[model samples]
Target: MFGFGKKQDQPQSTIQSEFVEDVAPAAPQVTSVSSASTPSPLMSVSSITLPGAYLHPITKDNGIEYLFINENPMGVPAGKPKERMTGSFGPLPMRTNYDKLLYGTGAAYLTGFFGGGIYGAYRGLQIAQGNSFKIRYNSVLNSIGRHGPRISNSMGVLTMGWALLDNTIYSFRGVSDYYNHISAAFLAGAIFKSTAGVRPALIAGGLMTGVVGSYGLWEQFTSEKKETKIPSLAPAPAA
Candidate 1:
């Protein structure tokens, strides 16, 4: 019999539908391709800061990274809990003015005392001019005994003046910088040489400033702290 009625067409349609379902095409999948010209920068600077020092990031061609320290950044250090008197005094950093006075003066005095003792001994040796061991020993002793106390006293005065000015500035400004040191040196020098005259006092101030500034720069250049490995807390790329 010829299939001519609408009912006869139903079987063909059902078979076509079933065939389509069984052999349906799959959805196209996508593959990602990198289009960037270069990878992300490896030299990432950190925001982590240190008091009284600048953290400068540098990356070497060898894939090593370093944090270079720039001391006495001559500006307010960045951080929270920023408070006055939060700076180093002599050999130590302090949170109060009292410590700056007490410890700073003591440390400076001791340093000067020992330093003067050595200088005095050398001076005594030169003064004796004799090659004799006994003469050298006596000269050294005499020189130290005579000049040591005076040198120590003078050092103490200078240290005290410096500490006073340094502490006052730090307390008022709440920052540690190269200027503070320079100013303190100037004031201390001016005061120490005040009796000499205005010209001598100015000269002394200039000399003191030069000496302090030179030493600070030299320390920065020669110190091992100039370059340090990136701190463990800093962000780093995964291995």
Candidate 2:
């Protein structure tokens, strides 16, 4: 009876040991699961979205934050969208308006006249080196008379042609000053062709278009960046 009681006690002890081992593993697992489910305080703080935060186009998804005119907190938000900004159809303001045609034509005529007179004097000097003063004076006068009108007329015609083309473009499409300037430059190539021929015309036209277009593009890019600059979190302290 004592031996039988000993065997029965052994079986009961084995069952208790197995039960303890299984129960001990389960408690650790429960603890680990609970800890994972509860997010850390640092993580919670980082996840909170601040006011005026926005995504940047070049940044990867969820990588960076930026402010725009609408999202800037430091200043009053824009009352209207940027797309609504449009130029006027009427004459430009007094401060901005200037007579390009008059200036251009006058400048051309003056340049031509002076240039012709200078060349004539040079040629006369060359031919009259061994002659009398009277003969030299006559030679100079004759050269000036011959070349002056030709040079002056040529420059005048070119300037007028360019001005006419520019005015026409402005009349039809005056909505954007930028476009007006670009179109004028392109058309002015024709006048260049009249003097310099086809290849030169193409080169001049390309240069003008490229320069104007690049300038416009640069202005646009800078303006957009300015509009989208990040605003300060709070107003600056008054001095």
Candidate 3:
């Protein structure tokens, strides 16, 4: 009973138990960077630029074309010729607005005077010899004939005065004066030839007058422009 009550000791090897805990190494952390993160050259610049043709299409080689560009471009217009203008001068004060008015009107009046005078004279002679109502129209015609050249000459003289003023104040040179005077003289010659009933002389004188008058006008027009004064438009300040 005593022996049975006493327990036998177990071998040291038989009582053994060990805890083996396996901790897997933390999975390798993989951080991925995208290639798209690289900046593009085009995205670096802030502004887009276009060529002139993009703004205004050009017509060349009988076809219209637009300018094409890739990448950022600096915008600049292509060289183009300017348009022509009308009237005697540009918006500048190189010449007065009506600088050429006197000369033009004078030329027209003179031409008409000579032409009318020749026609009136020829008709006058025909009416003077006839006892017809056409004679009544003759007096009216004669009145026009007598006054026509006179009015034309007077206009020429007045235009010459204006030309002198322009030439002096505006320094237009002798061009304006020459134009007015020569036009008057030629017109006077035409009238005289017509009054004398010289048909050939009338035609020749009228043609010559027109030619010389035209030449003088053209010369004045083509002459160099003179410096002109510009009137101020500014208002005076209050005192």
Candidate 4:
């Protein structure tokens, strides 16, 4: 009776097998980090690729700052979305010929001319040393008064005329190319100088043709270079 009551010891392997079989394997001990506990890595990051085509782009309306993008942002193509011209003030949109003429090109020329006048004045003062502060101030004022508004207004008029011609060419051809720039520039010079004389108009037109043609060629070369250049590899995230 005592021997029968005593239990027999099972093999260690059998015990192990029995234990594995008896317990349904616990669901995988999965570990997960909750989203609520951490901020996303992608938030508030700036993009270097496209300025206006990024997650959010600021816009300007009639010289006033407006925090807005296009109404249908997704409709915009990836490569280039019409936002504003580079180096343009206020980041104003240049979608139409009128917009470019009124604000972009004309405004740029005006600003540049005025800035040039100021810079020229400073340079003159340096060249003619020993002038007193009052003299220097007067000289700068005289230079600015003589050059800034006068030259800038003249350039603005010329730019407006050129823009009209360029847009006309673009509309007729249905293609944006250097030819439009060349033709429009020539016409603008010729028309503007036509007031003086026929010879002046021809000479002005010829000079403008050369300048615009050279610029267009340079633009083409640079664009090609940009296309051919290899993109740099992004760095791997830290562990």
Provide the clashing-pair count of each candidate structure: 0, 0, 0, 0
Cα lDDT of model 1 by residue, 1-239, tens digit? 11111122243311111111121222321111233344344422221111111111121112244444533233444554222333344434454556656665676678778888998898998899689999999999999887777877887788678768876776677565667777888999999999999999999889879977886676557744433111111122222
The residue-level lDDT of candidate 2 at 82 comes to 31
TM-score of each: 0.50, 0.39, 0.27, 0.49
* lDDT tens digits, residue span 1-239, model 4: 11211122332211111122222333432222233445345532221111121222222111234444645543445454343322212433244556656664656586768686976687557654456888777777776666677667767777778878887887787655567778888999899899999999999888878877776666557743332111111232222
Residue-level error in angstroms, candidate 1, position 202 = 1.4
Query: Alpha carbon lDDT of residue 138, candidate 3?
Result: 74
lDDT of 4 at 162: 80
Report lDDT (Cα) of residue 116, candidate 4. 68
Q: Tell me the lDDT of model 1 at 73.
A: 31
Error (Å) of candidate 4 at residue 231 is 25
Candidate 2 residue 53 Cα shift, in angstroms, is 50
Q: Which candidate, 1 or 4, has the higher lDDT? A: 1
Candidate 2's C-alpha runs over 4 A off are: 1-98, 175-186, 189-197, 200-239
| C-alpha lDDT of all candidate models, in order | 0.57, 0.50, 0.43, 0.54
Q: Which candidate number maximizes TM-score?
A: 1
Candidate 2 lDDT trough over 10 residues, lowest sum: 23-32
Model 3 lowest lDDT segment of ten? 13-22
